[model samples]
Target: MSETILLVGHGSRAANGNREIEQFVQSWRERQPAWRIEVCFIEFAEPLLDAGLTRAAQDARRVIVVPLILNAAGHAKMEIPAHIAAARLRHPATEFVYARHLGAVEPVLHILERTLRRAMLALDAPDPKTTGVILLGRGSSDRVANGEVAKMARWLHEETSHELVDIAFTGITHPRLETVVQRHSRIGMTQVVVLPYYLFTGTLIERIQRQIAHLRQQYPLLRFGLGGHFGFEEEIFGLLDERVRAARADGTARAEHMMECDGCKYRGLAEPHESHHHDHAHTHAREVPA
Candidate 1:
């Protein structure tokens, strides 16, 4: 049986956000026509997790969910797992595996580097030795998650000859956008362009734009511009494909594996049964007809 991949993303209210993801999935489908590829949103969008799972289970034995999120935070840690559990309950026979969020992956850094280079070319900004880059990301409460972005910043600084490079957040943690911009401005940097390490435009991007506007007024001599978000990048799809294949190989393929309740009353029967255990207590059990 063919395995299915569900490219799950933190859905946005902005139509462009959804459009980008859909376009990426379409591009992925074109590369591998035999495998099933579906896109679903964690929240604030249609064809949600449950619906996506149902659709995937139709012909697939296993479903791999790859979160497009940048970090392992509220959505990746709590909400996504809860939804996956709910889907498992409804379709116990299907195999489901959750892949890690796109956290500080090499391809991601390449995408950022390309975007930054393009932005500089468009504005005729000076070489990296003279210009500065601000690596911006949506902050997270998870320290590990925050550290991942910081590591990316350090990598960018070391890889490029930018006079100044720093990581800042749009929300959730310190070294906020405004603070980063002002600090660099004081150093007599002629051009400071903000590169958003985000996949789509949302409230965070809008907030960044407003911050950039305010900074422009405060420092009229400084030149600033916003780079495009990561969108329809081929490298992204290649990484996603690798993730899906890994999930399938890791014994998480859904359709090919089946779990049997040996103690259930319907164990000997052909009908489906639902079993629930409370608080990880293996002894306690309740069965319901399915």
Candidate 2:
């Protein structure tokens, strides 16, 4: 059957971030020429979800909606599915499959380790066993989603040489970067690294850099460093292809590695309810990236 892949990105206010997503999509398109891939944003960028879906479903027998998000947060749970449901009604003949998010899987952990090591090398940091590492995520109100980040922190500690590894959020949660930094400082950890658990640069990433700058001033005795985000990596591309394959097989994006939707409060509710508009205000200060 003819298929179209509608890659949905969690939009950002930063033009460069959106451009990165677009460029990523373009690369995927070139890499897999057989699949008719289309890119769209949930907000803050052109070609919003509905419009992009409309364009993608025009001449395909089946359309797979793959969320280019890190975690299955609010946007993946409620917002994107709602739009996909709407697209289903608008195009009854086309099959719409909702794929899973780019989850906290083993491959992602590998990429993060590489990012951390590179950052540490650049800083000429001390032994990983002694140095403190903080995994900074774009925080979410969904406790389940937030737990995934915490899980990654534990996994990183287990997989790496770092003995002191912690997890913190950029916004909308406790144990923010500053809080973790303060705790690390109190513990007398001389060298600390903050790894931004993100795929692209966004407002929150910028805010994190600013926060790190301020932290450097606050803790003059301690050495602080910011690591790179999860940019375009082969592992990430492999995961994206995995999602597409899962969607093609079962049409529900079901995979053993991906998070179960049963934990989501918004699961199985795809109607465009009034509450959809009230779906979390993803503003500059309130938003959390995938």
Candidate 3:
């Protein structure tokens, strides 16, 4: 049976950001020539989910849509599933499977650790005791997603020698990049590094640079270093391959791999304090450590 793997990205306004997804898809194709792979965006970029699905359904018996998302936010929990449902009606002959998003898994966490270590190395091997690391996420109203980033930060802190590892969002939720940086400055951290938890470069990355510039001016005495996003590492391919294999084996996302939606606001399980947060435009850095 012919099978096609459809990789879905969040889609960025920046051309290069979109290109990164396409380039990554190309590399995946090179690595796994036997499997048919297709790339698309959930929004903002060309060949959106619908179109990508249509194309994939054209010549495949099974179509597995794998979200290249780091965390299970609204998009992963709701939006992508809606798209998949719509596609199922349109292409009944082809079996459609929804795979899990790549959360803060071990491989990606290792990547972050390597990136932080490189930044420290670049800054003349600053003493980990006085150095602070700030991890930046895309930020979502979904506390679960934000919490995952925080968890990842904690895991990273455990993996590295950095004395302090703080979590911040680029946009929504509390403690944005600026807030975290300012707090770090006030606390008199000798050296700080900003590591973006992103897959590619986008408008948000540019905004982060601007914020970093302003923070530098505000705290001229502090040594600040910026780290890169999680780019096309070999482990990334391994992760994708794992997702594909799992989808093929089960014809759907594994229950264990799926996001824990017990407390999802969309499911009406929101806490009493849960309220909708304002939405913002979406937005990625350094030669990632190999």
Instruction: Highest lDDT: give the candidate number.
Output: 2
Residue-wise lDDT of candidate 3 within 1-290, one digit each (tens)?
Answer: 99989999888888888998899999999999998999888888989989999999998998988989887787777667767778889998998888777877899888898889889989999898789899988888777787888888999988877778999887757787777877887877988899999888888888888888988888888888889887697778889899878777876535223565655555543355743221111211011110
> Which 10-residue window of candidate 2 scores lowest in summed lDDT?
276-285
Residue 181 lDDT (model 3): 79
State the lDDT of candidate 1 residue by residue for 111-181, as single tens digits: 88888888888878676665678888777665666677888888888777786888887776888888887
In order, what lDDT does every prediction score? 0.70, 0.81, 0.80
Report the candidate with higher TM-score, 1 versus 3. Answer: 3
Provide C-alpha RMSD values for all models, in order: 9.7, 4.3, 6.1
Q: Sort the predicted structures by lDDT, highest score first.
A: 2, 3, 1
Residue 157 of model 2 has an lDDT of 93
C-alpha RMSD (angstroms) for model 3: 6.1
Residue-by-residue lDDT tens digits, candidate 2, 50-123:
99999999889888888888877677766776687788789999998888888888998998888888878877
User: What's the CA error at residue 59 for candidate 2, in Å?
Assistant: 0.8
Clashing pairs in 1: 61-254, 61-255, 62-254, 62-255, 95-254
